[model samples]
Target: MKLTVCSSVLLLLLTFSFCHGGNIFVFPAEGSHWINMDILLQALHSRGHNITILRSTRSWYIKANASYYNALSMPVEKSIDETFITNLMKAGVQFVLGTTPWLSSINILTKMVDIITYLHSAVCELVSAVLDDAALMKTLEDTKFDLVLSDPCWGGGVILAKYMKLPLVYYVRWQIGEDAHFGIAPSPLSYIPVTGSGFTDRMTFLQRVKNMILYLVTYIQNDVISGRLYQPTCAKYLGPDCDFNQIKTDADIWLMRTDFVFDYPRPTMPNVVYIGGFQCKPAKPLPEHLEEFVQSSGEHGVVIMPMGTFVSELPDDMANGIAAALAKLPQKVIWRYKGKRPASVGNNTLVVDWMPQNDLLGHPKIKLFVAHGGTNGVHEAIYHGVPVAGLPMYFDQYDNLLRLQERGGAKIVSISTVDKDDSFLEAMQEVLTDPSYRENMQRLSRLHRDQPVEPMDKALFWIEFVMRHKGAAHLKAQSYNMSWFTYHSVDVVLFLTAAVLLVLLTSFMFIRCLFRALCKRKVKRE
Candidate 1:
């Protein structure tokens, strides 16, 4: 009877703790960004947090039906639909492949910037929809959310967090125009490379110059173009003087979706937490068909290639060339592509719309990952200790692959060169035969998994920390709010420089007067 009473008391306490879990308002971007954000929401759900996800009516990936979280499906005029994204992907691929005319480079750059501005306009439209709706605003206010957990890629979350007067935590890997670090941390151009620059941390003179130029472009686009799109909303809803960039930096915690293990060593902020491979888990049982395919390989293993979600198909020739190369290999292949079936596809090659990427990577029979070098794929490869033959197309793909290449874990081949002279096969054969690649990746896996606490746990702790304390203001540095002049100590440098010049001038004047007076005295005496 005494032991039964003690058990009941313990159970009650556990239930009470779970019942008090924090309420989180989630605003996420579309496509793979949603994929990453959904994983975090799952973690939050398991911990009993009340999660509310806001999605537009046009989102195909993010549906309103889910058990773990409540949804606010708002009607919008337009969402960044897949057709829009796929066209952008194809255009980017053609540019990277150099198929576009040389003179079109400037046009492509301008169009890309315009596309980004237009997308931000869509986001601002959504933000305006939410803020302008009296019923929705009232409903959100009644919810009394503990904090806003947002993907900082979109400005809507930041604005809403302030509008609701809630503590904001960013689940982020990027801001509008550059890596998130450049926004919140100290990024020295000498070492820290800009995103899409395709230059590593250690750069040549020309590389550093290019990084600076890209930095300027990114800064102007982010501060001017992107900022202007959102600033009007900020003025109307947030405040007339409230700066958009300032609103972005005002986030309480930045749960950065990267780690030094997969990223370059760079300066970081205290409030910016790294949870690189938090989405990864041990291999689960494969489906019967996939299992049979793997078992058929016998001594040979399987190679799975996925080109990420936004890119559903490749050009026919490119797809056929890749398929032809994979067919000749002894290893069985499973490729996630929704494109036309390659004419050269062999019986050994299985073309599927999708496969369980994390599970497949963790399987022992998996040999090499032919990847497009997205952050999710790279981190998953690291988690599963799989080397990659990288075919980087656009965006940060090349840079992500470069990190693995620098560490001797992956090999990258250009899309332009992928089909030329059996380049795809050669790259695949090299990583497959080279034990060093797998060894290097395995070593990285150990380092990544050797953290004191699981990355998810750390992420959870900080998110809850903000909720319990109302905000993580104490962890945020004052330097984040300072201007460039004060943050870099330009004022102090100018003051010291002026003071030193004043002293030298004073000394020279006194010496000249003394010399002239002494000469006059000597003349008078003579």
Candidate 2:
């Protein structure tokens, strides 16, 4: 009877906790955001958790594109200080955030905050800004988060998690980090400076040294600058016990928003979870106009031209060039141009500021993606097994385009020098005619689709697992402690050298002994 009563009490407590356990707060990258996050939000909601979204106005594309010129320039720490705490308080969350800093590089110049400042300059700025905020510390004290989800780029996410006494889980929308490259040999392709294009796998002796030195320099710089900002916040709210270095070292969990197929022949970390295409949901019925457009575009297929959110001001020359090129093609073009359509466009060319991008990508009739090669766009193209022609403008786009070209699934045309007319037309013609591109894409798609679980589920499962297990320390890699020579294990080389030396010594001794014996025999015989 006593045992039964205790068991009943335990069950009741668990039930109560499940019913009222804190909600999940998602702080996404600004201006209402990318496509995959929606899937994550929906998944959380479906799992019976309450969800709140906090996003900044500055986006990933702000620096490169003029549209975000006004928004990006505003200090992020000021913006974050103004909004994040108030929103979290209002939502009554236990705490959760995706990545950190809407613009990390932009915040670096202000010296107001310290942010994780990833590979990009904007990331540095954002990290600097967040570290500077006073209110954020108070908020962390007031409502302690159980976990914080961060974009892999926002190295500061882990920092914030430590400050809040929460577990840090990196959320990647792309490939896994270098530590995770066990199964996949790093490809020789050097796309984005270090992270993109599998460069981690092919890093040479000198490159590794340079990378380590650079990483140490940046880490020290950020730590010192950001530590100064944290001093005030800690003095006011966290009671000086908060050590930023301790927090920096504890980032172990990573939740990737990438699918396995999209990041083929790539390395991954144990903590890294690939959840690309997580945002894909069942398609809603196309709007009447969109349906008619798709239907009218003959079976030869349609090409989607999406420049993405940041590049709103499409040049008239570029539009006219595309229009002129499309007029000569048999395929229908569904161009996503935010600006006015040029007069040169033919009747078959459909111009809209935005279309349901994923739906269009999934469309059976759509064959080509004329893209700016943003990570999201690249993922979508690969998800649907569609070939792409990248009009790369900045950042990782060059790397993404390079990866595509290497895979034989896409072609790249740099916007800096290529003429708007003949060059664009010729590239499109090549992609359309080339069967190899389509075949490679299809192969990738199949691999991506064969994953055992959906990316969101995998993410959530690991998140809950962290909560249940209090950080899977068992799964964490100790590579940070291993020296470069040790991690790669130079002992093998030493062993081979020793074996060769021993063999040579033995052969010399044997030959010398034989020669001495021959001389002795000759002397004795004589």
Candidate 3:
């Protein structure tokens, strides 16, 4: 009787533990990716999963539940200061914005290569710094994590997973790009735009050709240039046997920040899941001052201008021009500006360091959103049925805005147009006055919100599913094992061409012999 009771208790305990949770280690890349990771991590924590974040000292945001959701700050070099990050952002923004005429004239393929090369160098330094910390490495080694979740943008997360001998899951915060290629996802270059290609799904013949060329060039750059950069870093940390390509391809699951409602239809594998609006939540009541400010705008409504975290400030001329334009409008403007307050602030305009962006967008009286065309901003705008005036600056911003413009929910204002001031105001006015913009945005919002499962729930389910299935290896596409040539059927093409050539040669030889025999027979008869 005693033995049976003990066995029953042990079984009950095992069942309870299995039903509850497991250990999860999350390594998020720096910048806005961390914000997206926080949302998922918070959800995981709520589900009783023990979560630990391996983060840099300069992490942008830290969770309130520091004790519960543990963080190990990786020691960075003194040279890796805020100034360094700020300068990098500035240079990147300038390059993408086409502020430098020389850079603008450079071929897009060459520009992409340069961008990846810069990112590769930065990632190597970051990963090396973390690995060099002996104490942190020892602690991580001792911990028995069930799965490794990483934002694979920086190219270090996979290496960390390999070092720990753990299953890797990628929490991709942007549209599928090089990571998809590395994961062997079926991305047909003819349609699927390369990362930052700024092409919509419905492409012209020339656009398709451009897309294909971009993909081929990027593939070569990743393998030839970026691969070499990562090789030494992986060797130093994960040992000489580790291959970066293997580390990338071995990922168990990819939770992409994309939804069919927002993105154009493209082929995706079972392992690649779309969870675009996972960070969005129901709008909270605005703070008292903000509420009064929006209410004061009366029927004309308000416009919210937020350029995202990285672009805290704009150029002096641009800022002054925007301020001047806003002054002419009746609608109240709430501009999130971090630099010197524009001297031309009209009575209807408010300039602040930050505001509750989602809540403000959700407000019924919001006329339009003046955004820098960040994906998160676009998603929020679409979620709230708000039209946008997009001033696209860098990275996928142009692509995101282009799609919105195509869908009739937004208008794009080029930053370098001859009359940018007039163009900016015109776009803002157009989105505000155009009934089609609002109607289209409302339709899109319905589609986004009408998902069978909420994005957050979908993301959570897949995460736990991967944990339960121990990496969900069965979901990986067969192409994951295929070589580049074999996957594209280049080998088959070559073989078929060779066979055709051999047949042609054989036929010619036989015909020649027959002709020679006939000539000889004629001569003998003579």
Please report the TM-score between candidate 2 and the true structure.
0.66
Task: Count steric clashes of candidate 2.
Answer: 33
Each model's lDDT comes to 0.87, 0.58, 0.77
Encode model 2's per-residue lDDT on 333-411: one tens digit a residue: 8887666767887887888888888888888888889887777777778778899988865435666666677778988
For residue 217, what is the lDDT in candidate 2? Answer: 56
- In the predicted model 1, the residue pairs found to clash are none
**Models ranked on lDDT:** 1, 3, 2
Model 3 poorest 10 in a row by lDDT: 174-183
TM-score for each model: 0.96, 0.66, 0.88
Q: Candidate 1, residues 382-485: lDDT per residue as tens digits?
A: 99999999999888899999999999999998777656668889999999999999999999999999999998898999999999999989889887578889
Instruction: Report the C-alpha lDDT of model 3 over 1-526, residue by residue, as the tens digit.
Output: 9999999999999878767677898877656677677778888888889998876575446442474588866655432335555665666656655665684647543655465566567667767777777887787778778889988766777877877788888888531236354355667666777866788877899989888888777677667644578888887877787667656666888888878788878777778888887888778999999999999999999998876355454566667777778777889999887877768778888988889999999999898998888778888998999999888877777888888898999999876551364887787888888899999999999999987888889888888887777788888766756667888899999999999999999999999999999999999999
Q: Cα lDDT for residue 451, model 3?
A: 79
- Pairs that collide, model 3: none
Best by TM-score: 1
